[model samples]
Target: MLIKWISAAALAGALLASPATAVDLTVWAQTDLSPSASLGPVAEAFTDLYARFQRENPDITLKYEILPGGTEALPNLLTAASVGNLPDVAILDSFWVARLAETGHLQPLNDLWPAAERADVLPAAIDTMTFDGKIYAAMFSNAWRGVFYRTDQAKSLGIDAPPASWDEFLAFADKAKAAGMKPIMIPGADTEVTTLHLISTFWGFGGDLVDATGKPIFFEGANRTALEKTYALYRDLVQRGLLGTEVSTMDEKALRPFFYTGEAAAIANTSSGLQQMYSDAPTLKGNIGVFALPLPDGGRAAPILGGQTWGIFADDDAHKQAAWKLVSFMLQPANLTAIDAAKGYLPVNQAVWAQPFYAGDPLMQQFKGIFDGAKIVKTRPPVPIYPTISSALSQQVAGILNGTLTPTVAVDQARDIVMAEYTRQSAR
Candidate 1:
């Protein structure tokens, strides 16, 4: 017979368990909003929140690692996951969330956070994270891509406000050109920026890569029209010397110097750029304005909403629980307030914008207007093979700009590539 020996203190400790016995958690965050001088405040806000979280729960140690920008960090993440060493939490681009979820690498949050609770998030903000009818991540912020224009330039051009339709926009561009000003500053060499700006026009023209049936639909009337319009704009700008020869070499960073110095009348950029301009050129703060990209037919303006999201790694129950707690804490209204105030990103929590900090800001008010009527905003196709689809579009757009391919042919090629990718994804 075996003798059973248990200390009374051991029995009492087991019976009176505390959260201090919880597991440590690790978070991997991409460094998009951290390095910028204007955006540094936002990073500090997140750090403050993390500090408060640690103070509240001393038992659960939290570690956050900042990853490099762009695709350079993806390989490291993949390697870590392959070795069963994934972080407890990570921030992902909304576009990548579906792909990650499909790999079974992320935990679905729907089971833990009820649909009713998630209803608080804007529909557009939540759409990308929902794959196969399951919610996998929580939207952290809402971002919009549109034209940033100089208010005085618009006034001097006899335009009191930014164009409300594609026709009006073109007219304004023509007027600006006749007045000896570069109407728009676009970095043609930066495929990412060019593709993103062109996609906004595709949406404005009511074209999309995927349909309601979840089928690929890129070769069509609106898509062709949008592509033709984009190609024409590119050729006209390049030939007119409105866009510098260095366009092919200019990235978003290089294009910024042109805009801030007022070399170009307008630019297609994200709202975060506006925040930076405010800090770098404070005197020009009230001289700039933001507006949605107008449709060709003078109908509703459409803009693309893009941003990062918080996700949980598929892991043990304890880790999952701790991750959820962190997410919930970070999403609290106060935390979102701090985030928006610091980062210049729109809050996913609607209530956060109603705060005193944002209420008096006119530019913030204009952003709210654009965001409120942003139902037309849509994500690229949610298939796990979106990277391939994005690449094909980028290449086709480049070919169109380089005069190697017509818009019609480029769109046809993009459609074929998307269909093939869809087929490949379906097979898996």
Candidate 2:
């Protein structure tokens, strides 16, 4: 009896001293935002980072799913939530933060984040993640759009300076055409691309796309004139053969080869594609330059704020803490730089800004300037209904480019759709 009791006590002690079971965390990341080969740079970087996190936290496991679809990712998340299958963590566009927050699908990070930790991130990033009076997510990978051009082509055309106005841009186009090169690559097939052009042009013409109250005011008075002028620019580009007819069927990806081969003079795209450009043609490394989109009159309109935000969905306390630990691990100095470098995105960690890659690189020199001056377009306002507004507006813009509807008619229809959405949300 004594031997049996001793043996039982020893077994219980060994069990108590053994490691606890790991907490499993599920995360959904947008593959579109971070384009890499299926199991490419981003996947490898994240896998290694997760391993490091696991080493430190032996009791936590991470399972990350790469969700595709650029702008449509929000809908997938919402659908998942509807079925009570929301992941522990979600990576959503910063512009869609309000939509998810207002729907009560996000877990507020304020309570979990210490003030000192919050201060370590960029203020602008935090502002995007904040809804009402509370912070619901942590934003990273800040991005901005720019007028990327082939340096050698521009120099050969005697373009010693970036275009300062609309006339100058058109003049450059004419020169490029005379030089036997396509003036620009326009992603007319992409709704997001069309809307971005509209927003930049509209704002440059001193027109507002949305009012302070987050209502669509795109067709009101001078705003309508602004919209017409933007459309006219597109029509003029198409007429001059500077913007090829093939644009209606081609996306931004289709233009990369054109740019690399010197067939296309310039393209207005975000820095997200810059890394791919370098990889596609190493010879063009020193031949590319980035500039902000200039207004017709003179000055530059702000670039749209582009990036992703990480959120912890409402879940049990253990899950929330485990998810946050993963977030914190990914945000670490080495890990953040590795992932952002692999993905071609600007870092949200303020400390990383001082790193040589961003501070001293010649390629980054141009985009850094644009990022400093970029603004969030009205279509992506910090309101719950912005997703609906952006969707309606983009569809109409695509319609104009596809020739199914005139710009004037498209703008009118879009205005009505947005107004209707606003009214519906108000009543709700």
Candidate 3:
């Protein structure tokens, strides 16, 4: 047995607790919010939240085990869910919810996480967590992704100001080059990050990533033009010798150190990247800022929202109740604020916006406005095949940046690759 169920009433002196007999829940997670995982204020914030949870529920003992994410995690999850051999709780990525929920192993969270509680967060949280009318998970946080730049380094980079549109951005490149820094670095290798970071640009130019049937349409008429314009941005920089060949190998993580050291003028990143910079490169602290990735003339912003959610796998009522208690406590506005603020996640709970962190953080203040004015906000499509699509698009982007393929050829190849996957899935 992975868990040793102990009732809250039994742990306490009470003969009968309101929950009757809530068991201690076990958690399986791949999260990075552990105190040991970060330094400075981030560690302090996470440590305080965990300590507060312990103080609030002195009798409830919680246990956690690390789990892998991505390809390796899926089969293990499927097998466990099938046999009813699962932990009381799991921190499942939003990306995996569709496939896991389809297996009928995840318990619907509505019974424990009431509608009142659901209403406490952004609509996207509920929208993404629900699959076919069932809410299978409670979202803890999401990434508000955009362009990150160093306010302190702006003078050194020769950038007069943060660019608000593509014309300004193209003009800013010259200023950055004169200062011997890369104008902007985009990830081409980490396909999902690459896709998410650039999809806004593609969508802004009137591109449709997928058709109504969930089939990819990157090479189709208007989308083709939109994609060409998107990739051309990267191609133009390469042609100008502003971006080195190393950019083709870079992902979001690889883009950071350059920014941290003031070697790059700007880069694409999520909210968490701000805290990470504070932790990893303390000197960049107050100098960091973010802006929406600007679009071309007549184009609008398309922001992608991605999240992580808590999934209950405990079958017995006792363990399930305990899991909810643990999950709910972690999600409490004050506690979650510590986690979200320190870890750099955008808050899922609407109440957290009123917290001091949002008010004090300059980057968050700027991002909130960008989020408000965003023309399109959506999660990656909920279909199970979306990952495959994301990966294929990412590959084409790498080719475009590396000069291995023209924008036209890259999209054509991506269309064929993705359509092949749709065919395979259909036949199955």
Highest lDDT against the true fold, candidate: 3
Deviation (Å) of 385 in candidate 2: 4.6
TM-score of each: 0.85, 0.86, 0.89
Model 1 residue 253 CA deviation in Å: 2.4
Give the C-alpha miss distance for residue 128 in model 1, angstroms. 2.8
Which regions of candidate 3 deviate over 4 angstroms?
Answer: 1-22, 35-51, 69-71, 156-160
- Considering lDDT, which of the candidate structures 2 and 3 is the better prediction for this target? 3
lDDT of 1 by residue, 1-428 (tens): 12334576677787577565767898888765432223667767877888998888766788778776766666767777778777899877777776677668889888778667677788767767777777888887877677788888889889997787677878887887788777777656636666677677666666676667766665666666765666565665666555554555555666777677777887767775666767778867778787876654565436666677889994788889889988888888788778767767877667777777677778788888887776576766666455665667776655655667777777778778878878888888
> In what order do the candidates fall by lDDT, top score first?
3, 2, 1
Instruction: Give candidate 3's error at residue 59 in angstroms.
Output: 5.6
Off by over 4 Å in 2: 1-18, 32-39, 374-379, 382-388, 395-407, 420-428
Candidate 1: worst 10 consecutive residues by lDDT? 31-40
Candidate 3 lDDT over 193-306, as tens digits, reads 788877877877778877766777777899889988888877877888766668777778888989877788888777767777777888887787777766765555477767
Error of 2 at 202 (Å): 2.1
